[model samples]
Target: MTTIPMYDPLSPEMISDPYPAYARMLEERPIHWHPVMRAWVVVRHADCVRVLREHATFARDPGRTGEEIPDFRQNVQMMDPPEQTPLRQLLVGAMRSQDKDQLFQEAVAFLRGRLTAQEPGEPFDWMATLAAPFALHMSAALLGVPEPDDEAYAEISHGIALRMDAGLAPENIPQGDAARKRLNELGESWFPRPEGDDGLIANLIRRADKEFAGSHYIRNSAAMMFNASYGTIFAMVGNAAHLLATVPGLLPELSVPSHVATGVDELIRYDGPAQGTSRTAVTETEIQGTRIAAGDSVVTLLAAANRDPLVFKDPQDIKLDRRPNPHLGFGSGPHACFGSEFGKLSITAMIHALRDEGLRPCLAAEPTRRTTATVRSLDVLPVRLSR
Candidate 1:
């Protein structure tokens, strides 16, 4: 019987490239218990799916472990069914009733115009100049924030991302708390107590009663929106570009809009932005004959599960037209991502715009990955754009 490696969630190497370590963990023991973190890792597809979908047994509340992952407070992502349902409904309804389709088209046009304005041969940090800014701007627009220039928007969004990516560390806690306060102040100033449902922010305020609605709720919701919009969406763009650039004959295939959307989905499945999510066991349970005790943390490795051969054939290979690609790239069950559609649209638009400009990514330097235990993303994807 091989002993499971004591995986340190905060290790730089683990954040840089976690797949190798994940594979080893899965191979050694699918349900390995982490002594240091006091967490149980679920690396296989079936196990991850079960844990995420079985909310009754596994809870999303980090506070259950007596340790709250920093900045997760009051966010819909951490809430259970009764609380989560209404919040999700309000958000989804607002998105649907609003002119989001038009907004998305406008965002795409803006990106294309900007890309066209750039010098043909000029090399730029695509992630910084294009991917990150575009995501931040689109998100701000979606949430009805003031239309700041892409650079300014990116700066604020980057700050928020830094705070979020820090997770629940003591040193980073102060920064995250400060950012949250700043974000709340900004949201209040920008969208000050509208009389009617004017925008996303206004809608959130209206939805909240005197009891449930307040400055804190509004601010935390905005922060969550910004994090989802900027962090995950930015990483999606980088991952898509990186994957397309490496795959033989894939860039050319993304010339069409439909193909662009399909390719984006494949990239998400192949190298999702969020590698895994942790859930705490609410009660004693047995998974695949492995006994799990209450208060145990289970980390579901989504990246590993996406590549599980049991669920996907040739899972490592990118298939642009992969049909029935039931991947948990957006997660599963009640806690599934609420902004999946927006994310897909953002990625597709960016890829299509890049393809239209005949821009191909030439890797200038190896990607510098963001340091986080739960998410897999690149900090700086240095690439030279070429025709």
Candidate 2:
């Protein structure tokens, strides 16, 4: 194992492609202290798995640090079991009960509409016109909520995504809070939700009493879900599309349904948006010979772990048909992403729709990435579609 420099997420090199840095960490410092994150950076696949799964040892609650909880840490995403379980069950059940076929059809139709408007051979910003609106439409359909105005939705999405950075950049706290407030306000309008099969909201409202005590919890949880759905799917779709456009032969290969069904997971494993997530050690624990003390923060570099050579064969290359692909594009354990199914549906829908429509999109220019560290998303992706 060869050691390199300390890991830094915000470095310019990391912003463009973090995998090389991740590869270095996996081989050299699988678990070590990170000054920027103020946590022990865990890069090995096995170690990241352990950190996420052993919730009793590594808790989600930031309060374990014995510091005042930050504003960004107040939501359902930051809670542990007993407190986290019921809300998790309700949201997960609602997502599961969703008519996946209906969602898929709707997604395909929405994407087709956007693709039809694209001028062939003329470059267009895919992130703005297609990915953002499509994400909003699908998430709105899932929640059974009226889609907010585009301007408002964009502002909120940007803010909430920035909030995740508060751990590293405290200046983001204010903007993150404002975005969360707006999302909550949006969630508030959905209720007093009528009980019916309308969407996830109705399902949540009907089961709210059993799941949690207050409307506040339900509202915040629902808001969190909507934000996650729109923002996460937007990032995932954009990232996947970039791969299709840039990676040789991937577009044609994944255009097939059978291949894409498995390939979507590969895309996520290659470049997932939720790059890193953290947990606080509740008690002293040892990982790969490194002792982590109670109250210390352990940041799992999920994107890095996904490409660990020990776990993934030819870890750097994308194998669309790769099986037994136990990648943690989504975090594992008690807090695994609740919207994982929806994400897969959206990506597959985009690919299948493009193939059926005879539209092949290729990158017209280099794509630009968002400035944030925690969430790896595209800011601009220029492409030209050809029939």
Could you say which candidate leads in TM-score?
A: 2
Query: Considering every candidate listed, which one attains the maximal lDDT?
Result: 2
lDDT of 2: 0.86
lDDT tens digits, residue span 1-387, model 1: 776457766678787666677667666667777665566778789999999989888999666556654543566776777667776676666665556677768777867886777677666676877777777778777787765456655555555555543434446656656655665555556545556546776776676666555545546666677667777878888877777656777787766656666667778988888888878898999887889998877878788888877788887788887877888899998888878888888877776677666777777667777766555667787777678
Model 2 spans with C-alpha error above 4 angstroms: 1-3, 67-73, 194-197, 210-214
How accurate locally, in lDDT, is each candidate? Answer: 0.72, 0.86
Q: How many Å off is the CA of 194 in candidate 1?
A: 4.2
lDDT tens digits by residue: candidate 2, 94-138: 778788999999999999989988888999999998999999999
Q: Which ten residues in a row have the lowest lDDT in candidate 2?
A: 64-73
TM-score of each: 0.87, 0.95
Over 4 Å off, model 1: 3-13, 63-72, 147-170, 190-197, 205-215, 256-258
Weakest 10 consecutive residues of candidate 1 by summed lDDT: 161-170
Give the Å shift of residue 303 in candidate 1.
1.3
Clashing pairs in 2: none
